[model samples]
Target: MERIAIIGCGGSGKSTIAKQLGLTLDLPVTHLDAVYYDENWKPLPQEEFAAQQEKLVAGERWLIEGNYASTLPIRLAAADTVIFLDLPAATCLWGILQRRWRYRGGQHHKDGVFDRITWNFVRYIIGYRKQMRPKVTALTAQHAPHARLLTFTSRRQANAFLSEVTTSA
Candidate 1:
């Protein structure tokens, strides 16, 4: 599908899925982290961030990944597909650890992704399903009711979905 939106808690593999979907669909991928944060980890101004997303979503084909709930409607309104990585908190925490080790606790400038970890982030991940899922679900319904929604509760399901996509592509 074109104009895809990927959302999830930190370390839930939004970026990973976005990359795979981009490759399979031959769509350009935009990591919202790249758009929202700078090399120094400074965030872009809120208005500018929203504007950037507006422009990105206006494109004919794109795969944007992030969970900026406040700005979610922009992408949601435009996406033809939305993929939610609804993995358990434990899995997500483990993902953070693995990514941290892989990056050696630093930033990847090319991807504009930071691999830093903190207690707050852990807490957020732990609380995401309870706290954020409803909001995300509501937003998708409100803004992209026509879009195909795909929610994977486990990595296996996600992998199988990817395999199917790859085969079709």
Candidate 2:
């Protein structure tokens, strides 16, 4: 329960869940979005992103939320558990729509300055994940060989799973 990885498609509530988990556990949570996306919605160089993440993850306990496979293995190494949000494509889009709606209306989704860019960035959710699924599944198998992998196809299940995690899950 010391470290955890929340893996899922874009707009799949990975960051939100990780934030809540951090509050529940009172441990530091790393939102890879913040690390990967700089001001103006520009992406940090791979080397630079890796370096920044490498430094942040050196901590004894951390909860990393992201699906950037480039350096997922490194973070997964120290993660005691891996939570995968396995919602359907339509469901993912719905969540993204709701999230973007909130962002557009200045309700949620953190920074509002990047709300306009989110539309373009999110167009690849399905296609990208089609290619990313194999890698994600492989890593899930590789990292937590015997650890629990929770798949939620519905909001009910996802929320229930969170409610069930009483401790450092």
Worst 10 residues of 1 by lDDT: 105-114
Best by TM-score: 1
lDDT string, candidate 2, 1-169, tens digits: 6677788887677877887777787778877777777665679999998888778768888888888898887776666778888766677777777776766633232531223335555666766557777788888788667666666657788788778775435
Query: Candidates' TM-scores?
Result: 0.97, 0.83
Over 1-169, each residue of candidate 1 has an lDDT whose tens digit, in order, gives: 8789999989888878888888888999999888887878899999999999999998999999999999999999999999989999999998899888778886775653678798998999999999999999999999999899999999899999999999988
Runs of candidate 2 exceeding 4 Å displacement: 105-123, 166-169
Candidate models: Cα lDDT each: 0.90, 0.72
Prediction 2 TM-score vs. true = 0.83
